[model samples]
Target: MSRRRPTVSTSPSWTVGDLTVHRVDEIPLPPATGAWLLPAATPDVVTGHDWLHPHFADAQGVLRLDSHSFAFVLDGLRVVVDTGIGNGKERANPAWHDLDTDYLGRLTSAGFPPDSVDLVILTHLHADHVGWNTRHENGRWVPTFPRARYVTSRTEREFWAGYAMDEARAQMFRDSVLPVEEAGLLDLVDTPADGATILPGLRLLPTPGHTPGHVAVELTSRGETAVITGDCVHHPVQFAAPAVGACVDIDPVRSEASRRALLGTLADTDTLVLGTHFAPPTAGRVVRHEGAYRLAPVPPVAPVAPAPVAP
Candidate 1:
């Protein structure tokens, strides 16, 4: 299947009390990405859940995933949840190799420019999630958010540090992860069983399995709450079948356990769930459905248009 062009406006935002969470636009992954990423989500399995059609998946059951980042401001600190694939990066996957997109422009348009960012919360050190950590400049990869502190779990950083990496992963670290580290911008936090409160209302929930030290971000304010799922729950179809695991999951059994646990808490709640890779109408409320779970779609509030000025 061919790639679908972005149909939505530049920056779509959702409200969680006083905070306005923005979804900056990036390139949408090809339809084939679903099959390769989540082989467990076969056509038959996807079609079984009629609710997924026309939004999360095509009528033919091809899963729709995107590459974008979530941005918001908390307590005077400008935050970027994850950085999608960056421009001019080499990778083994053809879909993510040496491509270009106006990701930074979208971020700037959303009111969270690179230089103004104070914190970058990375759920893991995956290539796509960390791609925009650096940008090609003057024949060198430099930290995009020079002023921000890039954060990830200590376990995550330590795991990769001790492991033998392939050419592709090593290359990703060299360009995207290393530049930030060398600039003294990367910070590794210890995520405990009960999770860690990074700020007044922001917390890091340990939902490892996709990676040993992977985490899901939780934001609470004025009694309202939301969770930003990294890769733990890639598509809403996983809500129906939490057992279905991704192909790249470092630990499949543990991954499903984490998904099931996370979904159990989220089921039948008012808490908003923001998917890291979900397509348009990305955020939603989770509710019990046929003994499982499903996302009751919550479309983002349209960005207010600027007032017209007299010529």
Candidate 2:
């Protein structure tokens, strides 16, 4: 199932071999988010990659990043990758604080109501990525997907356990992450240097640097493959300059090495790269461009509604 065309949906999905990965819409991050998150990506750096325009950047070169999740049912498991910044969370970042978007409604429209999710994969413990892990209910935070097992890397969990976190991060854990763990629903896996296979065809590839325990998800079905970039590669600009990294990266050097390594394997391959923060037309393939790399955009298939049944 390598290199299949995308299938459209009201929720915007891409068909990888046999699986239809839905991009559940969350609120678009403020334009300022680009400058704050990836400071190294200057206007000059961005405008140089003309391919990024109209989709990934403006004519002014301000990057267009999004906050969304990928939902799909695979081998009887209904999965969600990286819950976006949830509603009603208290945060220091103005863009993410006290969001009131109808994220749950959008998820339900995509056929994945919170309760129906079987697994919640946390790429890392960043506030934006894990904000939807729980919901404010009855004056307390509770696991939104009470029935699902929330998973993240053990190393990632342990790193934060010992690190000194500011009030904001600690508050994020109190509201979004801790409740799931307290519910005995959090599962931490040991991701080695190579990676770890969590299911038959789903693998977690170690993509540290953005975070100590961060990982990018790899999905395969019918010989077709797609890799979800979980913060390791935020924007398409990185495809053109893998060295440019996120500002919050715990280890900038390792982040660069990891980015280089991941891009190296993906370049000129048939695998579809799904960017966690990429704006619309979010999925694409890595290609060699002017001695570096670029994402050849893959737009979602235009959605067609089901035909009416005879009365």
Candidate 3:
């Protein structure tokens, strides 16, 4: 499960028409072997895919899922979709418990300082996604982006408000989620009937089921479209086998349906995709590979432009 990462640009930027998007990474997780994370993502299947190699999966067929975030800069607004796992926390999972990283520094490297963020969206308040919503401060947790309005669906916040089934979930809610609520910066928004338009070009599309109210952030400008997949579909292996649900998915059945629908809408189109947990060169387009689908990673040198997706 060792991840031998190659040297690559940490902040890989994308231009979706006028809006600029940057990938800010937190941690490069060690590879998960043979459905350790997804039941159908076995070594044989991963090795056979061919397309996942050297990017999603290694030469030996180990899968690496990163905890990362996307910063979208449009007009005068700087919004971050899904903050990566933050430092200093207690968790049932040892890898994520009591740790530290240069996530904030990388955000600054991506031209987004903590204070510069106007809005921070929690796609769903999972440990990895919402960890950076707050930070440890003087024996307490505080909103990391103090000036930003931390946004989440009312359904999501309300569901997690009472989610104390396990110690880790309780601690995560305590340290990462509630502080934003206490700060008076937590904007519990209702998912719009049409779509939640944060600004003119950016939208939040409700693609629930990974969590009760998970959302995928969409960016559209000057006739181009891009989507930030927030756990709707995590690893690219799911692209070829949509039925393979993640262990962390709250409702595998619902998550599978959501994944299929999301892929159906995105397949063989110009819409650029940025996976929340996809490995290096994370941005790409969904294309029909044989009969199934695949996340053809956008080449680091130059992306292959596909046909314009219908708006």
Cα-based lDDT for every prediction: 0.90, 0.90, 0.81
lDDT of 2 by residue, 173-277 (tens): 999988998999999999998889988778899999999999999999999999999999999999998888888999999999989899999999999999999
Each candidate structure's TM-score, on Cα atoms with residue i matched to residue i, is: 0.94, 0.94, 0.90
Alpha-carbon lDDT of model 1: 0.90
Q: Where is the poorest 10-residue window by lDDT in model 3?
A: 302-311
Off by over 4 Å in 2: 1-9, 304-311
lDDT of 1 by residue, 191-302 (tens): 9999988899899999999999999999988999999999999999999989889999999999999999999998888999999999988999999999899999899897
Candidates 2 and 3 compared: the better one by TM-score is 2
> Which sections of candidate 3 miss by over 4 Å?
1-10, 192-194, 300-311
Candidate that beats the other on TM-score, 1 or 3, i.e. the better one = 1
lDDT of 3 at 274: 90
Name the best candidate (by lDDT): 1
Q: Any residue pairs clashing in model 3, and if so which?
A: none
Residue-pair clashes per prediction, in order, are 0, 0, 0
Error of 2 at 64 (Å): 0.6
